[model samples]
Target: MTSMSKSKTNNGNGTVDSRRQEVQRIVKNACDQLNSEGVDARNYVEQLAWLFFLKAFDEAETRREEEAAFDDAGYERRLSGNFAWSSWASKTDHPDEMLEFVDGKLWIKLTSPDPKKGLGDDPLAERFRR
Candidate 1:
């Protein structure tokens, strides 16, 4: 019998940390909810889109408020404002750049066409389409 060689696997320790664990927990909960409703987790594109929109909206609003305060302070320093929602889109005219900024797995779930055997026919999708 030939000996089997084990390939070295990187766990991406550089990217995995406490913060990543928290995010994973949140995603797992959402998936679990979908599973309980007899809905395929992969068909959660609509939910993902809504969440993304809310998150981006909150971030953009917070950044705008912070930036305005800085401007009022007469601080002519460039603030690394949080790029989310239309603020992120406005940052770059290039489609690629716009995509790059929101290229996380959550964003992919929202924008990808018929991802994972295509989105199921559901009211959530209908609402999202609007």
Candidate 2:
């Protein structure tokens, strides 16, 4: 029988690399979609933050529901009307106010360590920083 050589593998490092690539891919896709929709390419970073915040909020809510019985009051308490892009955009006729609302939510989500309804650590915070 021929001798077999074993190849060493770094699963942990591979996992990290995989995750990094996945995040990059997601950001790229989001940017592409935004561009296709006629949004300014420069706004990709802002859009990324907004999408990330929405996704994180949805995931956190799902987790909460699975972990505990559904609580309408708790759900309502955690809801952030500002999370809705269209709603926030319409809040003020001025572009500055719209940008402010979006930026404010982005900052809150990025800084919060704990899951708070509309608040949580932004998953795309790293991308935004870059």
Candidate 3:
């Protein structure tokens, strides 16, 4: 059987890097576990990409709020409800509900053609549109 190779990185100053190892270990574990349950490896990776995109966008929205970049009231009103990652991803009361949401409303918003409304020209949303 093949062994998982340890990940390496350099600080550009020639040193053993542990950061890469941690991320590699995390991803390897997730993929291994998911694949064992008959999940296609590629699909698992794609779903992970979606999650990372949402988390990153949520963070960016928070930054924009702090900077007063968007219409404050409007921004809060837009995301503070079911539209926010926290609500659909973490705070959902049931697993099935979250699944329905991820495949439904979330998908719709990311792919919304009305650029002036949902996600509105956001590059990350475009990445998740598929």
Highest lDDT model number = 3
* Candidate closest to the true structure, highest TM-score: 3
Model 2: residues with Cα > 4 Å off, grouped in runs? 1-17, 32-39, 69-130
> What stretches of model 3 exceed 4 Å from their correct place?
1-29, 69-80, 115-127
Q: List the lowest-lDDT window of 10 residues for candidate 1.
A: 1-10
Tell me each candidate's TM-score. 0.39, 0.36, 0.60
The weakest ten consecutive residues by lDDT in model 2 span 1-10
For candidate 1, lDDT tens digit of each residue in 18-105? 5567777988897887789999866886657665565655566667777879788432211124433545546556868755656653
Model 1: runs farther than 4 Å from truth? 1-17, 73-130
Q: In order, what lDDT does every prediction score?
A: 0.55, 0.58, 0.67
Show pairs that collide, candidate 2: none
Candidate 1 shows a clash count of 0
Query: Which whole-number lDDT from 0 to 100 does residue 81 have in model 3?
Result: 66
RMSD of every prediction: 15.8, 10.5, 6.9
What global local distance difference test value does model 2 have? 0.58
Query: Clashes in each model (backbone N, CA, C under 3 Å)?
Result: 0, 0, 0
lDDT over C-alpha atoms for residue 104 of model 2: 78
